[model samples]
Every structure is written in C-alpha cells, then in structure tokens.
Target: MSPTNNKKAMCRYAGAQNQNVQRTALPEIIDRIVNSLDDPECFAHIGEEPIHFSTSVREMIEKFRNILFPGYFSDAKIDSVNVSYHMGQEITRLYDILSRQIIHVLRHDCLRYDRECSECERRGNEAAFCVIEQIPVLRQKLAADVRAAYDGDPAAKSHDEIIFSYPGLYAITVHRIANILHQRSIPKLPRIMSELAHSLTGIDIHPGATIGERFVIDHGTGIVIGETSVIGDNVRIYQNVTIGALSLPKDAGEKLRWAKRHPTIEDDVIIYSGATVLGGDTVIGARSVVGGNVWLTRSIPADTKIFMEEPRLIIKNQPKETDSEGN
Candidate 1:
C-alpha cells in the first residue's frame, strides 16, 4: 500500500482507540448508575429475566394489521387465487409471535408480583388463539369505523384513503384490538399496545375504555379517552376532546380502580373540537351535540346542544401609516 494511505489508516485506528479509552474512563459512574437500579421502585429489572420486547410486540401488531386488512399493509399480492393461503399463513405467523409475547408478559408479571404460577405458556397460547378467533368480528367493526369516517368527513375522498392514511382510524384500530385484551384482563400487553398507537398517532386512548361500533374520531390529535369511559354507538368526537374523569386525590388509582370515573356519551352523540367532559356522573345523553371549547362536568339531557356564548370582539384598525410631512 502507498505510504499516504497507510498513515491515514493508522490515524483512524488511533482515533478509535482514543474513543474506546475515553468511554472506559467512566467505570466509576457506570457502577454507581448500576447500583442505583437496586431501588425496588425503579423500572429496571436488573439480573431478572428480560421482559417482553417492544419490537416483537410491534411486529406482531403489524402482522395482525395485515391479517385484518389484506393487501393493504403487505407487499405480497393478495387476490382470490391465493387470499386464503395468505390469510392462513399470516394468522399462523401472528399466533406464534403473539403467543411468545403473551408468555413473556405473563411470566414477567407472575415473577415480579410474587404471584402464583398461572401456566403462562398455556395461557399465552390460549389468549393468542382467542384474539385470533375474534378477527372476523374485529374486521366487521373496523369496516363500520371506516364507513363512519368516510361518511362523516367531507374531505375523505374514499374508504381506501381513510384506511391507508388516517391517524384517527389507526388509533381506533389499535384501541379496538387492545380493548379485547383489556377485557380479558391480560396485564401490561394491552397498555403497551395502546401506548404504541398513542406514540404514533398523538391520540391517547386507554384500552379499558368501552367504545361501541360505528364510533368516529375526526382529526384525533390531543384526544384522551380515559379508563372507564363508555362511548356509545355512532358517536363522533373531534380533535382535542377529553372524555375524562374529574380530579381526585393522590390515592385515586387504588380508590377508583373499578369505578366509572369518566363521562358517558350516549348513542348518536357528536362532540366537537376542544371539548372537555369530565366526571363519572356526567352523561351526555343520546343525540346531543357538544360544541367546541365547552368544559362540561354535569349530565346533559338528550338532544341538548351545548355551546359557549359568543364573545364580543373589539377590532381597532392600526393608525394609517403617515407619509413624510412634505408628501
């Protein structure tokens, strides 16, 4: 090799060596940080068996999505000729991935909480099968959701557009799947699924929320549907809406575990943007319309339209620009 090339390679090797030395110099700090993880409250599980991997969970979700909507999210050609074969293959793959993840979650909980052995492997397989069996019903519900979005939004060009690009639909899709697991009382996994959707769509929907069919969320960013929220069929809500619980004390988590803390929107209701409806006793009755920026805490009767009084505006034009005195 040429002398110049050899010298440049030597310099690169020296720089890498120097970086390694600098990284190793932090041994004391690294030891302190590792020791700090001994705190029981810390989220780290040092020396314990590894928990369910988020990447694996995400892959399972994607496979499930492909199963739910064939040919939409996948690269493979799905038609009448090979659709059944494709579906069967994808379902079997999803079942494998999902069962493994379920085992990890159940085992982690069993060990972490000092709980009795629940035969995590068997239960995981059963849960995976259960979720798989309900895909047909889930597909029906998703079809209704897609139709609702297309029917409700004027800008929606087609059902295909809504399914492919709408964040609201994506959030709802994840929520529906997560809700099934939540109903089965599968711990950790459901919340993880919901949070994955939340992270992607900027929509926070708790898996515990009971949302009915034909439900629509338009421009769903900044929307929070809390645990125990009961949303009825054909309900539509817009962006920045919060169907949440009233404020509670520090021990609310324990105190309100099974409590119906969030508001209920009856069937055929429409809640517009920036509305906040809070409290367990608060129910927006059937066919009601809640206007934007309305902070509601109490129950309202059916067919009620709640809107804020129009604010008076004071418009003053800026002083006309003055030309130079000579002009």
Candidate 2:
C-alpha cells in the first residue's frame, strides 16, 4: 500500500473519531427537554400510554396492489398452477397486518369514545374480515375504473398498459381499498392509505369520499376530492380540479364539523381541468359537462354544459434590450 494513501485513510479515521468525541451532547439540556415534553399541557400524549399503531404501510400498499391485481402486482411469479396458493398466502399475510393495525387504532378510538377496550380484538377482526371479504367487489369496481381509463383516454394503448402505468388508476385502486376500510369505521389507517396514494400520484381523494364505479381522472395531478365529496358512476374529471368546501366562519366550529363540505358530482358528469366546484349543495348534475377553468358553485341542471367564454389574446412583441455585458 502507498504511504500517502495509508495516511489519508488514517486521517479519515481520526476525523470520524474526533466527530464521535465532539458528540458529547448536553445531557442536562436533553433531560430538561424530555421533562418539558412529558408535561400534559405541552404534549397531548403525555398522560396517555397507548399501544401505537406501527406497520409497514408502504409494504401494506404493495401487498394491497398485489391483492387487487393478482398476477400483475404480486411479488411472486404467478401462473395457474401456483395462483391459488399465492393468493391465499398473500391474503392471509395482509389480513394479519390489517388486523393488528386495526386493533391498535380501535383501542385508541375506544378510549376516546369511552367504549370498552375489550372489544378491540373482535372489532378489529370483524373490520379486517369485512374489508377482505369485499376484495372481489373492489376488484370489480377497479376493473370498471381501468376500463373507463382505457375507453376515455386515446393515449392508452391497452388496459394492461393503463393498469401498469397510469398514476390515476393507482391512486383510485388505493382509494377503493382504503374506502372499504373507511366505510367499516376503522380510523387513521384509511387516511394513511389515501395519503400514501396522494404522495405517489399527486391526486388526493379522501377515503371518506363516496366514489362510484367507472370513475376516471385524466391527467390527474392537482386533483383534490375532499372528505365529504360524493361522486357517482361514469364520472370523468381532469387535472387541477378541486371538489372542495366553500369556506365558513371560524366560529362555525364543531357545530358544522360533520356537515358536508364538498360538492356532489352525479353520474356521467365531466369536470375539466382547473375547475373549482365548491360547497356541499353545489351539485354537478348527471350528464353535465363542466368545461376547463370554470368556477362553479350552485347546482346545475341535468344534461347542462357550463363553460367560460373564450377570451381574446392580444400579442405584442417586446423591444429587445442588450444585457450588461452588451450581448
């Protein structure tokens, strides 16, 4: 070995050792910070020692994708001979993961509602089974969604490509699975699942939202479907659409907490890019076509087409100026 290289390596080792020695952190300050955090006034979890729900949510989503599209999404090489065995094994694993997570969440919820903690295991099992039992139905609904995408988008070459490549379908598939959990009243996990999809696709559909079959979102980025949004079958929405709340005064408070905040989009409606449909009472009627960049609030009649008038664009060439370097 070269002496120069050995000295360089020795210097790197000495620098690492120096950094470790320099990490003699202030114990007293850390203790004070810990004490401060332990105070109930400072931290909500201070008085409570709950069994926190911890699971591999990313892995859970992957498994969920596998379950939804058996051959396409699973880790294993699926064929007719091994398909049944793989599905059963994967489902069983998913069931266990969901059951554990559900119990953790249900226990916390029971405390909040002053319900019996004893029912956690049973309730969690029921909820998990409820969700699992509906996987076929969910797959059917997702198949409709995939079909919608394939039929609606001219860019899509095939249903297989749509399933494998489309972000909207991925988000919707996750939402469907999470929606089932949300419907069963299992908390936290649903939102977590949806948010995972949101992070992946930049399409935010709250799990609480009621979305029907054959729903499609084309160029789905910047789409926001709020908590109470109700969507019907064969509905197609484009990018930058917000089916969200019309804001209320701050003092409205918990009185209006459970009240619907988002719009009800009926069957066969088409909402285009950059359209903002706000308020619970604001209904985009069945078969209505809302054009791009339209701002709608009130209820529209069925078979109506709402769009903004095209504005004239006046183009003027700017005078060219030289830079400081006289380019």
Best by lDDT: 1
Q: Give per-residue lDDT, candidate 2, residue 20.
A: 75
TM per candidate: 0.92, 0.87
lDDT of each: 0.92, 0.88
lDDT by residue for model 2 over 1-327, one digit each (tens)?
Answer: 799999999999999988877676667668888878767676455344364533477777788789998888755698989988999999999999888888878887777657766588998999889988999998899999999999989999999998898999999998998888888878888998888889989999999999999999898999999999999999999999999988888877687778998899999999999999999899989999999999988999999999999999999999899999998
Backbone N/Cα/C clashes per model: 0, 0
Cα TM-score of candidate 2? 0.87
Q: Write the per-residue lDDT of candidate 1 for residues 250-316, one digit (tens) a residue.
A: 9888888899999999999999999999999999999999999999999999999999888899999
Q: Which residue window of length 10 is worst by lDDT in model 2?
A: 46-55
Tell me the RMSD of model 2 versus the true structure: 3.9
